[model samples]
Target chain A: MRPVFLIVLALISQASLADSPPLERQQALLELLHQDCGSCHGMTLQGGLGPALLPSALEGKSALMLTATILQGRPGTAMPPWSSLLTQQEAEWLVTQLKQPAPPQDANRH
Target chain B: MRNQNLNNFRYFLVCLMATVFLVSLPRAPLADVRGTGDLGLVVERTSGSLTAINSTTRRAVGKITGLGDLSHASLVYSPDERYAFVFGRDGALTKVDVLENKIVKRVEQAHNSVGGAISQDGRLIATSNYDPGGVRVFSADTLEKVADIKAEYGDGQLAKVVGLVDAPGQKFVFSLFEAGEIWTADLHDPKNPKIQKFKAGKEPYDALISPEGRYYIAGLFGEDGLALLDLWNSDAGIRKIVPEYAKNDPKLPVFKMPHLEGRALVGDYWFLPAVGHHEMLVIDRREWKVVRRIPLDGQPVFVIPRPDERQIWVNFALPDNDKLQVIDTRDLSVVQRLTPGKAVLHMEFTPKGQEVWVSARDDDQVLVYDTETFREMARIPAEKPSGIFFTARAHRLGL
Candidate 1:
């Protein structure tokens, strides 16, 4: 009975770990963005104090290109570099979230 | 065999019905028409965004975004009014539904297609891109590329293509800046438009042909004059330069700018913004000479004649005492000073000519002033607002 229980536990742990890497990174980056940058970037990142980062705004740019912009902000514009504020890996994760499609808004539908 | 004969007969009847339906019904219009009331247009250069405002209440009803690095976005309404094509900085073009104020599609290929000319029928749009040194053509419907014309600037080319004006039929006229050349293309067959070139001025910024499309006039920057070129005689290979206002007057101080601001064609005369002489250099096309110098102060960026032909609305960018100068075309005198604003770059008029849309760069807001009362009605905030065009009648024209 103990051996059988151990086998079942290992199977469940492996399945959970398979989904952990990207999901955990995405959640952490989103939390940091919400706590640190949401003051200007808006909660959903629709862009208020800062420019919009939704798919509509960053249409032609690729994820890697946008990540570079996050690390090294555009010059002569209000955007500032986040290289000092965040690690390169973290910045890449944040850009990936920004590139993702904006979730459909339920209350704002009207 | 008998059953097959009946099937063939039915098919022929259906084809006949379709042909009759197509032939009897009037031809469908080209583009969708958008607005009827006052439709406000603004280009936010820094953010690469555009907004369509309702002029009456001063509310932003429609929004267009993702236009790349839009420095000078020019809006053109389709004859049917359904769509408004915006030409942005670095040649980014986007089509918007003015009524919905939503971006329909964007053409990212024309990187330098800044400003362009749309055919009167709304069939073709000709854009002169910089880096590739050519004009790009796009279909009004799908925003798909239709043609490309090679018109690169030469070694001595001092001016860029300031603006493009469509002529009768499918001809497109491109006004070259320091190059002093008006490049014309026949776009009836856009895939291979016949190109023609004519020399005009030292640094011709904007050129306008007569309503009948006979004469072409370009404002020569810093030269204190306007150039008159006869397009009617293009087939004769006759190119004449009318530099009547070329000489600077000693009394007025020269306000040297890198480029000419704007030009207007009224009847047979061409009214060009004279930067050096502080006046509207009006040149008679027939005589090809400066008939009158309408005294103006600071630097004029735009001079739009009222539809009534009684007055002209002149907008300037310099923070000199006068920013909005209303010139009485009959006497060519400064009739009224509209507003005292810093760097009034461009002006657009309401459909009925009741209000003037003034883009104040220093203030980053669009000021709406009543033409009759000359009072500031409302100020719509924008970011580095550069160009404003009306889309009120765009939908009907299908532009």
Candidate 2:
């Protein structure tokens, strides 16, 4: 009975890990946030045609709401839906990253 | 005999010392003494640097660094093509001497700037600002503020300026994105400009002046048509053309805005990139009517014409940004489709249009191709490149 319970626990953990993107994919998504999304929103997310995505600007916004916006996009604006490219989990991950304080200047590789 | 040998040794020493002195002196000044006609600049967007390239040698001669926030940077050259007035997104106006490969003067002109233009006579430089929305003109040589024209609208509200271009008669034309108006500043007198305003359509996102500097056309983002103003006939006011081109079609999502520039006009037909659609709209310039719609691989970003106007090279927005297509002007058909690289940002033709240089930002390389044979000629290393401006633009109107 103990062996069977341990197998079930391991399976559940594996399923959860599979839901999240891999390490390499997370890096790629961060790059996309900086470059592709940066084209409209400033590279540092300070705002251009689009609004700033900095932590200060997004302080009141919920992570889930931001994720939904990323997935469905704002209609009638220049912001287009990124659902075709990003999954729900990935979009949520990006939102969390945006909500955090920007890294140090030297940390930006590019 | 010993005295004669000693004299010869002294002569040899003198020659060796002279050769060393000549070689040790700075060679940069001598090498930089060249005409600016063959020079160009590549905006390394990510690095906040400009790679000064030589079209004749097809090599990057020098890299000018320290210009801040070059993500959406653009520049116009002096009439002599020696100085490049770079407009940064951070509202920094930097005048760079391309020959000297350094910044002559830099001023944080505004909180944010979209682009800029130099006057027809090349004496004044005008920058279109996004933040604290207004147009500021400066002395091209001194970078000193000459005039300030705020884009004030209803109840003192400011509107961001876009698509600023230089016109023929020492004039500057630009569109107010939020206010839906077009303003022309006649800077015949550097300090005082005669400002003319016209009511345009819903949202004028970008604009371009005609090659002959006769007409100013602004593309509307809020509506289906474009606003055209005839500089030759100021009394005619602004006319909306192709009002029903996309009225019946469902609007698709636009990842990037289509750039409206001077090269869209090819002879009688004006080839323009339709917003939110994977198509190129070919309009009859004489009647200002949509004549044909050529389907494309993706939403066209830039519809650039080759120097001779025989072919038009196009790059698309995201999801199809890696692909580049060329259209035959005569047939109005897609002639060639090539996958140059990731995020193909901008393209520029040689002075005579024999070869074209394309910047692929994500790949960190600029690919040069032969226009006639459709062959890859060369590849230049760059850091997230965007705009490729050649000195030949100095002589052309509305570049």
Task: Go through the candidates in order and give the clash count of each.
Answer: 32, 0
Q: Give lDDT tens digits, candidate 2, residues A1-110.
A: 89877865664354346556786777778778877787778777777778878889999999888998999888656678888889998997787667655421222345
Per-residue accuracy of model 1 over A22-99 as CA lDDT, tens digit each: 655555555446423432343344442245566678888887888787777655332556675567767755665555
Per-residue lDDT of candidate 1, residues B103-178 (tens digit): 8898775534447667766877667555355677888888888887656557633334655777665677776654
Candidate number of the best lDDT:
2
lDDT of each: 0.63, 0.87
Clashing pairs in 2: none
lDDT of 2: 0.87
Give the lDDT of residue B107 in candidate 1. Answer: 78
| Model 1 alpha-carbon miss at residue B40, Å | 3.3
Residue B291 of model 1 has an lDDT of: 83
Report how far off residue B184 is in candidate 1 (Å). Answer: 1.7
**Share of native interface contacts recovered by each model:** 0.00, 0.37
Residue by residue across B34-78, what tens digits does model 2's lDDT show?
Answer: 688988999998789999898878888889999999988899999
